[model samples]
Target: MTDTFLIGMLVLAAGLFAVGLFGVLARRAVLFQLLSLEVMLSGPSLAFVAAGARHGDPAGQGMFVLVLILAAAEVALGLALYLRMARTADVTDSDSIRDLRH
Candidate 1:
């Protein structure tokens, strides 16, 4: 039963990762892109936890926590950049952001 549960959790995490990747590739909207990034980061965190549980190891949990911190920092920086760009360009699309170079 435990093995089955672990496999299911891993499969779900993989699916989340795939969806996040697809969203990043296919979405043009900045907000959707950000959301997809979050999903991508979170999927691995969940997988880490599941792996730790399956292996009975504490290091995986620790790694997951570190990854979470990194993800938070990334979100902060990304949001700050988006805010600066939005203020100057008055648009949130990535293509329009190119106007900021000049």
Candidate 2:
């Protein structure tokens, strides 16, 4: 029963990862892409927790916490860049950010 539950969790994680990847590839807006990237991160976090639980190890939860910290830092940086771009160009779409050499 526990194994089955873990398998289901893994499947859910995979689905989230696929959706996140699709968002990153198909979306045109920078905000959407960032949101998708978070989703991608979530999938792996879920997997880590599930694996840790399956093995009765505390490391999975620890890894998930670390992933959260990393995600927070990434969001902080991404948002700072997004704010700068918005201020400079009033831009939200990634395609318009091509002129990055300024």
Candidate 3:
């Protein structure tokens, strides 16, 4: 792997992360936020893979696996919360659910 390739990969990772951050902050819908969160997670995952490939190290790949596990857990928990919120009340906007207590 060349330096230019590494730089490009890093830039791409940054872009993915930034887009995800924008989605999470700009959108209020729970589903969109979840999707954005996944995108955000991907940024680091890609970075880890790229770096690992560049350095010929397995640690980066290991980290990527951990991130994947984290992302999966987060999705499961987030969806459960979203479903619960949806059943109890309107879940169009996140602000409305400020107080989970019914």
- Top-lDDT structure, candidate number: 3
* Candidate 3 stretches greater than 4 Å from native: 99-102
Stretches > 4 Å off in candidate 2: 99-102
Q: Decide which is better by TM-score, 2 or 3.
A: 3
Write down the lDDT of every candidate, Cα atoms only.
0.86, 0.93, 0.95
Instruction: Rank all candidate structures by their lDDT, best first, as comma-separated numbers.
Output: 3, 2, 1
lDDT of 1 by residue, 1-102 (tens): 398999999999898898999988998778788889989988888888998999899988999989989989988998888888778778688777777688
Rank the candidate models, highest TM-score first. 3, 2, 1
lDDT of 3 by residue, 30-95 (tens): 999999999999999999999999999999999999999999999999999999889878675787
Minimal lDDT window, size 10, model 1: 91-100
Compose the digit string of candidate 2's lDDT tens values, residues 1-102.
388999999999999999999999999899999999999999999999999989999999999999999999998899889898999888898988887657
- Cα error of candidate 2 at position 22, Å: 0.8
How many clashes (backbone N, Cα, C below 3 Å) per candidate?
Answer: 0, 0, 0
In the predicted model 1, the residue pairs found to clash are none
Q: What is the alpha-carbon RMSD of candidate 3 to the true structure?
A: 1.5
- lDDT assessment of candidate 2: 0.93
